[model samples]
Target: MTASPLLRSYDDGRLSLPNRIVMAPMTRGRADDVSAVPHPLTREYYAQRAGAGLIVTEGLWADPLGKGGPGIPGLVTDAHVAGWREVTDAVHAAGGRIFAQLWHVGRMTHPVTLPDGELPLAPSPVRIEHQQIFTKDGWLDHVTPRAMTTAEAEATIAAFAAEARNAVRAGFDGVEVHGANGYLVQQFLAENTNRRTDRFGGSLTRRLRFAVEVVEAVVAEVGAERVGLRISPDNPENEIAEEDAQGTYRTLVDTLAPLGLAYLHIIERGAYPALADLRPRWPGTLIANFNGPQPTTREAGEKVLNAGLADLFSYGRLFIANPDLPTRFAADAPLNPIRENLIYGGDAEGYTDYPALTPTPVG
Candidate 1:
């Protein structure tokens, strides 16, 4: 039978996806407090959502200093690798593909979240204004970050490459660099956030240096075919600001086009009209995330795909409440509403307990 557009299989011969629906990465904060290993519930959580064509795990910090907040998972130690193996095994057993999202939050964190109560690291000593980070103590105002020296910046790149190797060892199908949402990579990309006179800052090309280096290192560690990138241009989240969102992202995307990566995931809201102009420039598959206020529905996804805007559609909150999302979309079944309070740091209550579509009573 011919499949619906959303249900069509995507086999670029490198990344084989059963459908066009993807599960976007979201931080659930359910990892172990001390070790930063994924809790047992995390294993069950991904196993439940295995119906997604591709499941991108929550941001996994590459090292201790780069950690964002309490309970965020890490890929720095043997324990972390062992813990993630179970998750990947479960997803594969359930006939699903999964990817690890490598992340470094830079200055989007507080002392409580860092080791030895050290200051957060960034390209410059800029403190994100009017922002607070959750900690073991409580939400604390962000502190001025210490500018990373050239040596430290290069070391961070090496850490990302090392984590990519660890992700492969943990049995993930591929890896997605989390260069979005005002995190470390995005901090380097935005002009206002990066104010150095070095090779890693100043001009647009210099500002994009960190992201390109990290991607190159990961591509070297894992083949380019097994890697992907996520970016949100001009997004002001986490106090990020860009003077020229369109020009900067255009150059960045153009630079990345020749890498022969798996796909480019772009988070778009209606405000960024330039996103449309940037979409066609990417030669590989494009995953467009409708990050607006409204939930992404079948109609919206179909419209984008029909218009040749994106090859895959990524859903976040909806996927949180609907594990068998693809099946429900195919049947036009009712979706479960997300429990707002239970989204952050919860157990199975909001993570894995959402019921899938069940049969109605026989008359």
Candidate 2:
């Protein structure tokens, strides 16, 4: 059979994907509120989209302090492992593979979400302006975060390693360390957010130390082939900025090149011109996410793959609205319109109710 540009099979040494489509990690607040465990609806949600070549689950808190908002899932406790086992089982039964995205929000969290109502932690004491944390009470303005001590930073790395082991116990095929989107890992990578004179801050090399160490620890728990890292060089969200974007990311890609990771996921928002320059530096499968206010279309994804920009393309909103995205794309069928109102903090209304093309009754 002649291979289509988007539907072609791909093997990246570690992952043998049926197609070049990836369901990118997206946070839908459908977990149980208090326990932070995934509800049944979360399991059904992932099983519905199992037709994708690969599915990266929503960002899960690695510890209590990492919890970013209400209804976000965690991978810390026994209850969390039991909750995710159902999710992984359903996906595997439906002939799909999944990877858990381990996350720590750091300063992006609010004290209300913390265990003792303590201030959130960050590489520095800088506050993320113009952003609010969603709480059980309501959305509140971000508070100033306490700078993490060197000891605290080391503990955080150890926590990440523990979470990686938990992900395996939960039956995940692999784990993706969330080092992007201005969270704990990116906060350390960015010069403005990380201003310490210690090993984890100051120069570009020091700033990258946290990310490198976290990846190393995770690799120790889970082998390098079962590990992936996501990075966004130009993202300005969560009050993030770097003095030299190109130079900083070039150094990062070079440092991580020797690790032999499964893949590298990069979220490109067009603001960073370094994607073209940085793509060739790393010799591994690259998953490029075209991110912005606008939704990514199949044609746009094909363009990136056709131009050799990325080995695979990841979609967010499209996969949310159409569970059977691959078949729909193959037949040029109509797509379900995304319900903007019900994107987050909702029930099965927007999560699992979207219908696929019904098969005709066989005579």
Candidate 3:
């Protein structure tokens, strides 16, 4: 079978690959709760799906305050680092490359999820529109978060920088900053969420300050070649909506363009225009998330390759059910059905139970 340009090598020197299909970062909530480390089973789980050209590990909390819910793993302590080392080593032993997705949930978290019911942080002290959050004390309505002061905001940037350092030390091939899905960084970028009047708010450039600063910090710590940024222009997951959608993200992409970052992972949203528009502006690799109908079918993936919309394709739910997803995609075989009920906060039920395709029985 002929390979599409989507399977071509990345111009960025940070990641080497035989194809361009990537196993997107997914949250499995299988961490060692007491120690805040990855469960041993988690290592075997990722090792099972080592066939993808690249695998982006689930979001790992950078600090304790960044925790969104119970069971989410972290990279804060020596134990966390040691636990993740096993995971990365397993992937490497299987001849697969992976990147650690550094993340923070911001106000999407509940006070109970925190150490002592401490208020979550946000750019403004506004409560988000009716949204329920999972906490240690069960589900609860999200409360108005405490507005971060300039000092606190700067310190938060430091915390993210430290997390990037921790990720490298934890034996990851590279790092991807979780800037999508209405998290802390997305909250700051969205006008409706960020109501501050300081350098981090008010104007487009100011609103994008947090994301730019985070990327700059990571670039400084580990070089831009190893840093990737994930952004979704029209995501409504955490009630994120920007008054000026296209203008805001265009500026966001253009500003980071000069940095020569590894890749821009764009989660496709209908409100946003064709990703091809952002292509000429960003010289680095472009990875698109297929969210809507038609999905990223082999035909559609090939079309994207021919049209040059993205350099790589990020498979989300498909990665969940098919550990050998790349091979299945190549062979055009039937996929293992995903059990939605077992998507999150479980043991090895849906997390690692998915089976790879086997040869049929002889007649």
List clashing residue pairs in candidate 1: none
What are the lDDT figures for the candidates, one per model? 0.90, 0.90, 0.83
Give me the overall lDDT of model 3: 0.83
By TM-score, highest first, what's the ranking? 2, 1, 3
Query: Which segments of model 1 are wrong by more than 4 Å?
Result: 1-4, 360-363
lDDT of 3 by residue, 1-363 (tens): 456655565645666787888888888877866567887788888998998888999998877878888789998888888899999999999988888998888888878877777999888876776778876678888888988899988888888788888888888888899999888999999988898999999988999999999899988988888889988777777788767768888899989999988889988775666376677778888888766644356566667767888888888888888888877766777888788899877688898889888867999
Residue-wise C-alpha lDDT for candidate 1, range 148-202, written one tens digit per residue: 9989999999999999999999999999999998999998998878998898999
- Residues forming the 10-long window of minimal summed lDDT in candidate 3: 292-301
Model 2 spans > 4 angstroms off: 1-3, 360-363
TM-score of each: 0.97, 0.97, 0.94
lDDT of 3 at 258: 93
Query: Residue 68 of model 1: what lDDT?
Result: 92
What's the residue-level lDDT of 26 in candidate 3?
Answer: 89
